[model samples]
Target chain A: MIDIYEIIGLIAATLTTSAFVPQVYKAWKSKNTESLSLTMYLAFFVGIMLWLVYGIHLNSLAMILSNTATGFLALILIILKLKYK
Target chain B: MIDIYEIIGLIAATLTTSAFVPQVYKAWKSKNTESLSLTMYLAFFVGIMLWLVYGIHLNSLAMILSNTATGFLALILIILKLKYK
Candidate 1:
């Protein structure tokens, strides 16, 4: 039985996960990623991967799904940053 | 009793939370945000705030601390994005 707090966490996860979309879209459309920090994305990618492992450890669907999606998006951003540079 | 998974979670939290700092530093140093997506930061800020509330509800120190730090950093990024634009 999912409680209110769990729902809140899921919402948070969803928002944070999807938040990367616009940046990716902007970067993709503009082909400009000068302002995007490569260091930040590199660290974030590692962090998200760790979070995915943790989610798997806990068998948490929310964490797993969110981190997976976020990781993929973050990767694209990384590649875009490098490519545009 | 904190286990290995808990430690991994903490590391993951720390990495993701701290990841924003580089972006902030880069933007602050560069004073150029032409490529930073305003829409992304706005949504991310709200997501971090929700994560903070969820963390508080769970009474998890890792989540609370990480989210609080991340929320502060995300807010700064948002402000920098708007200000520099």
Candidate 2:
């Protein structure tokens, strides 16, 4: 049986990681990322990559799923920042 | 022997999560979050909480450490946004 903590973790990961979606959508739709810093996104992108590697090492599905999705979303912003800026 | 993957994971978590420090510092020093969207930070704050819960669930030291640090940093920015703005 899954414990309450595990359930909470799952819900938390799902919600927070998914939070990037709106920002991603905004960046894409507006085609503007001038306010967003390239340095910040670059650092974040690298950080997410590391998290992915760490997730893979732990063989944890939650880490993998959340980081993967977050990484992708961050990447979208990074790309938009690049493309539009 | 410690595996390469685990080392990578540790490094990744440390670097990426810590990357927020500069932004946090900038926000703290400049006291300017006008460009920052409160919604993004709010969502990120919630997401980090979930990640923390997930980390606690997995009993992963890396997750706990990284998320805790990230959450704290995000919280700082959030507070500054509130206080200064």
Candidate 3:
């Protein structure tokens, strides 16, 4: 049974996770990482990975799913940054 | 009492949240949003705000604190984007 709070968390998770979509897309399209911070992305990626692990421990589907996606997106950005630079 | 899991969550939360500090600082210092994706930040900000609310509902101190900070930082980035642009 999905709790109401989980629903809220799911919504929030979706928003935050999808938010990076455009960013990863844009960077890939234009190969422009001039405005994006590599350090920030790297740190964020690492953090998200940890969160994903934490989510798994907590049995949170939202956290696991969102962090997984965010982690992937951040990885793309990282690769894009390196490739473009 | 803070259990080991909470401690891990707290650490993960701190890392993920604070990860954006350098980013916000760099934008503020360089006044550069060129690399930063406005849409991403905007979406991320909204998401973080929702996460904060969700955290409050869950009674997770780490989530509340981290999301609060991330939300604020994202806001700073957003304002910098508009102002610099």
Candidate 4:
């Protein structure tokens, strides 16, 4: 059975990672990413990459899933920044 | 000796977590957080908490350090949101 901690983790992951959705939508709709920093996203991208590797090493599905989605979201922003900026 | 992957993880952690500095500075300087979302920050805070637990489990300094810092930064934003909004 799932514990309270796991439930909390799932909820947390769902919310935080899903938070990117609005930003992604905003960027996509406005097609303006002037305020978004590329350097920050790049760094975040790399960070997520490492987290993915770490998840793989640990065989943690939650980490892998969350980071993979987050990485993709960050990548979208990065691409948008490059394209629109 | 640390491997290449560890070095990359360190750099990623430093950059992404440190990226919060600019946002924090902007919020602090302007004393305006109208644009920041409270729900997002709250969600992020919880996510970081889980990541911290995960880091502890794996004894991964990089994960621990990055998430701890990010959690604090996210908390700041949450507080600022509550205070300003």
Best by TM-score: 4
Enumerate residue pairs that collide in model 4: none
TM-score of structure candidate 3: 0.85
Residue B49 C-alpha lDDT in model 4: 87
lDDT of 2 at A32: 81
Expressed as tens digits, the lDDT of each residue in A1-85 for candidate 2 is: 8667656666766876866687788788889887678887788888788888877777766767877888888888888888899
Docking class of 3: medium
Worst 10 residues of 4 chain B by lDDT: B3-12
Ranking by lDDT: 3, 1, 4, 2
Each model's lDDT comes to: 0.82, 0.79, 0.84, 0.79
Candidate 1 lDDT, A1-85, residue by residue in tens: 8888667778888889888788788889999888778988898899899888977886656678888999999999999898889
- Sorted by TM-score (best first), the order is 4, 3, 2, 1
RMSD per model, one decimal:
2.6, 2.5, 2.3, 2.4
Residue pairs in steric clash, candidate 2? Answer: A16-B47
Location of the lowest summed lDDT over 10 successive residues in candidate 3 chain A: A53-62
Fnat for every candidate: 0.80, 0.81, 0.69, 0.39
- How far residue B44's Cα lies from its native spot in candidate 3, in Å, is 1.9
Candidate 2, residues B1-43, lDDT tens digits: the string is: 8667656766767877866787798888899988667788888
Give candidate 1 misplaced runs (Cα > 4 Å). A81-85, B30-39, B81-85
- Give me the runs in candidate 3 sitting further than 4 Å from their true place: B34-39
Candidate 4 deviant stretches above 4 angstroms: A1-10, B1-8
Candidate 4, residues B1-85: lDDT per residue as tens digits?
9866566566667876886788887898899998787877776787788878866766767778888888888888888888889
The candidate scoring highest on lDDT is 3
DockQ of 1: 0.67
